[model samples]
Target: MTIILKEVLESEKPILRNLYSLYLHELSNFTMNLNLGEDGAFHYEELDDFWRVDGLSPYFITLNEKTIGFILLLERPFLKKSNDYGINDFFILNQYKGKGLAVQAARKIFEEKPGQYFIIQVVENKRAVAFWKKVYTGLNIETNERQDLIDKELCLIQTFKV
Candidate 1:
């Protein structure tokens, strides 16, 4: 399977919105405490914000021409000390889990968005931690782990340089 990261554009908002809805829904139900109400999910308002920001990028993850997931990379001034770039959001459909596809997608992000990067995962989300751990270790990348509160919830923040 060929995994690719395509820069999401304004005309592709429909596709991004659909994926974002699913991503937020799954995360809310499985990992985070956020509630998803009837056919609607959070993150609708932030759709355009990414395009407006200079440091934020939205990429669509595709495998063999099929859209499966997305990665949101942001450049923050500071996090856990020095890293400027962050993996703000990453999600693969339930059908696409356990195949190391995400690792490849992440590796692509590491390549395309080169710099001292960080990915923050909720501490309660063991799957996320494991996934990020695999991506970091499989790529032979060095990581510095830290703990920080995001939205009043503690999160495991992993920082690395690529």
Candidate 2:
């Protein structure tokens, strides 16, 4: 399948909101083993809050113009270095998992806009740890860990030095 990753347009907010709700619900269910009440109604208000923030560049993963998933790429100042950039909030729909779409999308992002270092955070939960291990091992990435605010949660930061 030809998956297209494109910048989200303002007019597509409604559809993107619905897709994001599905993405969040699936992610919560996968990690927490329970849905965090990410129904359409609950997400509608949340999406409104998200849009209010500036510098949030959300993208849509589409197959023939139909959005199947979404990812938010935010360029923010790094805590380690004030001049560096960070990418945050990446998610894909559960139905589209195991398709290698994320790797392709990430490659496209780097190709279009290169960075000195690309970092992604993985939670310390069992599933996330396993997933990140595969990704890091496949990509030969180096990682470090730090304590997160939540108990039993750690910030597994993997960096791609380019």
- Local accuracy by lDDT, each model: 0.83, 0.58
Residue 79 miss distance in model 1 (angstroms)? 9.0
lDDT of 1 at 76: 61
Candidate 1 has which clashing residue pairs, if any? none
Tens digit per residue, CA lDDT, model 2, 1-162: 677788887778888777766655644533443344533332534455345666456778776776767767655421355323445555666666778776656555655655544454536345545655666566565655444543333455555543
Candidate 2, residue 140: lDDT:
62
- 1-162: candidate 1 lDDT, tens digit per residue: 779998899899999998988887767744555666575565656788878767678899999989899988887632345777888999899899888899889888888778888788888788888988988789999999999988877899887899
Off by over 4 Å in 2: 30-40, 44-54, 76-84, 116-125, 150-153
Q: Residue 3 of model 2: what lDDT?
A: 72
List the candidate 1 regions with Cα displacement exceeding 4 Å.
Answer: 30-33, 37-39, 76-81
